[model samples]
Target: MAARAKREGVSPGELKGRLLAEGYAQRDHPGIVFRGPWHDRRAALAEGPDVWEVASRLRELDGPEEHRIAVLCEETALHPRHVRIAIDYAAEHLDEVLERIERNEEAAKRSRRAVQRRAALFAAVPDPGGRPRA
Candidate 1:
């Protein structure tokens, strides 16, 4: 463990905690998987959205909890069990999950702005055929 931790550049205790968290997630939340680059590691459904997506949807929803879960399940086409797994995991790791969500949102906003800027630049360029853009 120490050698692995040294190689990973984390303390032995941090390594142990990571292993424990991964193991517990696998055992208790089979549908949930840790993914992304090391710096942006996050919990997500095996073949679906990140846990934060589920949690965020849950938060956006109104009405009773059960109703919100049902709506999320319907909207995402996920089973109740999968939705519950994400919700439960997010509850336990609220800070981490929320941070991930915030990061993703910021990334999405940046991407949208980049796309808009590129489009604007392209629109300003004269057509190769010498036709004016209307």
Candidate 2:
């Protein structure tokens, strides 16, 4: 969709705006999708890209204890104010927040598994490109 937007000489946000103006409706996902003619379409788009990024980063940091928004802002290079926005947004959409957390956890698990596999392989085999046995 981004590529399409780029080719069309418009930012993704602009493309969405055009779609909304043309009666496009949002579907399951962060961005918009064309499912059918807009029905009771919203007058304006919800959150922007920055808010989405902040929310996603917050979700990735999910764990036993809550983290400071300042720390998250530092990690994501987002303004501290966006933290409040994300928190408010999450409060209103608990299910989506939970889904994001679950998705992030699954991704982390996959990454750890890949690292372990690579470590095992490297441990079992010496570097073939290194200086030949002397």
lDDT of each: 0.85, 0.55
Q: Estimate candidate 1's alpha-carbon lDDT, on a 0 to 1 scale.
A: 0.85
Query: In candidate 2, what are the lDDT values of residues 40-112, reduced to their tens digit?
Result: 2221124333333456666567553246676785675655554665555556556755665667679899999
Runs in model 1 lying further than 4 Å from the true structure: 1-13, 24-31, 129-132
Query: Relative to the unseen true structure, what is the C-alpha lDDT of residue 47 in candidate 2, on a scale of 0 to 100?
Result: 34
Q: Which candidate is the best by TM-score?
A: 1
All candidates: TM-score: 0.75, 0.45
User: In angstroms, what RMSD does candidate 2 have relative to the true structure?
Assistant: 9.6
